[model samples]
Target: MKNIKVKTLGAVLAVLAIANSHANETAEEQGEGMLFRSLFGDTLERTYGITVSGLLDIGFSRNNRSTSDERDDGLSNLPITGLSDEGLELGSLHLFVDKPLKANAIPRVTPLPGPKPETADFGFTIEALYGRNAQFSRTYGWDMGWDMNEEDNAKAKRDRLSFMSVPNLAATAYLPYGPGFTIMAGVFGPIIGYEIPPNIRLAPNPFASRTYAFVSNLTTVSGVLVGTRIMDGPHGLLGIELGIAQGWSNMRDNNDDKALLGALRWRTPDMNTWIDYEFMVGNQENESTRDIQAPTSRLISADGQLRQQHSLNGWHRFSEHWLLGMELVYGHQDGDGKPTTVDIVTGPGFDGAHWWGANAVVTYQIRPDLSFSVRGEHFSDPDGFTLFPTTTARGDFNAITAGFRYDLNHNVSIRPELRYDWFDAIEHDRPFGNGRDRTQLTATVQALVYF
Candidate 1:
């Protein structure tokens, strides 16, 4: 807790320093800064030039189940469970720095006669982030049929207050094609998480002689991203970005991942409606098997396991005060070829499934700086992907959320939101006991200040 407070104070100080630097710049310098300011908006203008920005997101909610169940298991088949009663979760605190190729250097005004133009725009950026959340569990209590004693429960509760920090660093190069088009390429180092590595082996016998053990394994990732934007005419605009990364740990053999995304904005003379689509694909090697008899059992291979998602959203403005929007999302995961494990066991073929959902939202502008919105979403699993061994039937879930946002100033905004979620069943037979359904009420107060 003390460490978090200190980090929060550092972030606040960074913001103030950036503001002071911009205030002291001369008019000519400000005019040159306007180009970047207009391109990245207010948020990027303040932080992109400096090297640090901080964010704090604290939320509270009430749930019928324990908080531990809310953790995302990375398995789409797992039945979603557990929620918090009331607590604070830090969303992110980001510190980034940009390094330009030329420092305080002036470009030549006149080009060589009959010579092709030569210009170079290259830079690099490094970023660090901190995020926190509460973990909870449901099986340790007497109500869940567990025979655990009081001491075990207390130990588990103590473990739930842990936090995680992630640091990311990347380098970028900008290539200009003309007045309004440029291609950007970047490579980022691993996003190191301050927790136990995801995949590791724990031997059963302590004194057993080890013939083959891979000890130098570490959790790391590397990725490349490219983005392009065109501002040709006044009628519309187009933008696209793609990224690919490879995992450096032993979770899978020959493991490499990929992601692709694109967006387009179009507006008529009146500028009333717009549409967007986003997609992502990731592949990871599944659980591995080793033979005890063969010293050469550590063979490298690809498991052909992957997860894919796609989302499309559209919005239309009827007037200055009202807007309507709809969104569709689909996701699928193909478990490894090995027969899925019940408790650290593996066997053959695809063992998982897919799910999809649709949602709609309505927004009303109550004032120039305030807006109210309501949203509804429904989700279901198809092909009956199983997470827990007790059941094979996947149920449906739905949620409704309403919220309002108040802009305190141009760079800061506050949002208060309320949400209700319902699940069809805990499993197939455990449908929330009686007709009374599984429900959760969540309230969140978020403050956002950019740059």
Candidate 2:
């Protein structure tokens, strides 16, 4: 408790100091400073050329099929972190700051230059977050002040008051070699996925809630990433990134092995259409299973085993008011049967499991302040590798969602959504309600305020 208080105080002090760093600069001289002030607080000004923004999200949801507890919400087949089936929930509160890059900050070299281009500038971003969504975004090794000797359950430990979390704390530096080649280090999310992370650039959220594949396969990566543009043109653009990280959903290195991360991002000529290809190879372990492994259990290899994942996401705008988004993801984990004891380290008997899924969303803008969207998805977890296991076998889940966004004003918006999920019964009986139901329905409404 003392440490938490100290940390909180330190954070508050840091915010104040950073917020006041540019006290001497006027809005005109600050450039991007004025833009941020207009959106954030009236006093919110750029400090050292860094801009600041924030968001607050609150939501209410109910699951019609949940019978476990009337008061407690249930989200069958959905990511456990976003669960809010039967009550109001504080989704997240986020504050982010980033230094704007300047065109002439770093020198750029061209093979045959008609005119030498200006240098690239250095930039960095830091995001401080709180609430249930923040907790769900926690990376491994981030201590929640839990007593390991008394309890090892991740969920149970999180039930305490450790709600604050830092999901993005990265710094970026551009190189002088070529056109703005840059390296980013620290805790940052992957450059994949169609769903926008909460509290990012001011944009309309495509949906009021999240999807299973979004939470299960797409998580944050910790380490360093190097990125540079392959082609930059008014008609089209291409970029590539490569990096090495601790591992999936991990904040600290758990072993000697490091994960490989790579991505390719492309945008069409108009910049309204874009696509991304992302891949990762590494090792991951379910801390719960490994903690209780008996010494006599067959010696498992260091870092456990191999886990690989791939994803492709794209989006396009058909007109001023209509747009579409799509995503495809596949993930696999290797767990040889010989090491029976270590097989369930990540999940129930998922020694060798694979999962694949696809989802599509369509959005229609009725007016400048009103919009609607619909999403449908299907995922297959053969051997229950990527999803919460029920009955230790392969299972399939299908889900559909519909939602609409109504902007109350420039700084506030309201969203309401309905979702349905169902699972296969042949592979395993009821997967929800303590294995009592095969389908679930849910409804949710949320509000977002930007600053």
Candidate 3:
């Protein structure tokens, strides 16, 4: 896998050069005004800080079908035929660390104790994620008339190796009474060094299977989250927040299933806003009644499931240059034994399907180290067709992306990107026969660092 992603990116740049050489010898014996008041802090001992981040991505692409068939049954079945060339690519590598513990560093130049009230803090976040191509079946494509082949569909090839570690410990308690309130809690876990393929949406072509030992077996996911907030001043200067989460999967086989998530946010001092929701229930494997041809339907058994997801996002800055954003997502699935017809012609049986999407973005700084951006997205197909008829139908698809950014300082950053995709489907089966469409172009470059 590209020499194990270049020896895990040279061991994360040798641990970020030993944490920037111990933060530059602790900022030359704490000069620079007590090292910027101990990494940014001052009024009455409010001290807490830590940050380390990473991202590196590279890309190129062009397509139309048959590089041995890359599936996309709708949006006009287009799989860019046989190896159209481009070059070097690897994306998704993230490393994170963030810390803070109760803060309050003087300011108020004389507002008496009138406002200095809101308090409560605790924090932790540690993360590592690596991705190459990172599935979605190389951006959708797959079907091969069932009996799945190509080495069991090369587990949707996107060049593999998957590892993710997530740890977060949190706390927030500020509301010694009044307007600026707070109450938050946390717990997180997502340790998976390998074994991924619990059906990343039945890969037909999810970015060509991207590593993780070509999917499945080796798993761990643990969780707990809680939250509450209402701040506007007394240190927070802004307000609104809410959160919830519960999770478990193979945490020693507690019936092997569970999940739920919720979120909401709004902040101001500068600007911030947000919203989120999620739900999931699990158990899988049925592959259209295991292709029922009898023989006890090839020894039937394995297909217990229920899944759901909903998402919405928004961010606006309106100044300090400009920024605006939006996103919406919906999903669903339900399955449990008996209910065939190859599961309603492959839309996956007993009725229930949904998909809705929307996204828009605009950002501009032009200075402060340059910046620019644009984004768009649309997708639909929560069952408007395709429950078999030789499979492949569920909303035509549309996509667009653009970018530019540079900030070699204040942490670090670099970005260059372009993307375009299109698909449509009504019917013409034979792996999406006649009714097909194509259009693809991709280019990417990214680098980010923060500490």
Point to the candidate with the largest TM-score: 2
Off by over 4 Å in 2: 1-47, 68-70, 73-85, 103-117, 143-162, 199-205, 286-304, 345-351, 389-393
| lDDT of candidate 3 at residue 124, scale 0 to 100 | 58
- RMSD of each predicted structure: 14.1, 6.9, 21.1
- As for lDDT, the candidate ahead, 2 or 3, is 2
Q: Weakest 10 consecutive residues, lDDT, candidate 3?
A: 104-113
Stretches of candidate 1 off by over 4 Å are 1-51, 64-85, 96-120, 123-126, 133-168, 178-222, 247-273, 287-302, 335-349, 383-393, 409-412, 426-437, 449-451
Q: Scored by Cα lDDT, where does model 3 land?
A: 0.38
For model 2 the local lDDT of residue 166 reads 69
Clashing pairs for predicted structure model 1, backbone only:
68-136, 338-348, 339-347, 339-348
Indicate which candidate wins on lDDT.
2
- Candidate models: Cα lDDT each: 0.40, 0.61, 0.38
Q: lDDT of model 2 at residue 108?
A: 13
Per-residue CA lDDT of candidate 3, range 105-142, in tens?
11100011234345654555544444432222110011
- CA error at residue 112 for candidate 1, angstroms: 31
Model 1 local distance difference test score:
0.40
Off by over 4 Å in 3: 1-49, 59-90, 93-95, 100-122, 126-189, 195-214, 217-222, 225-336, 340-451
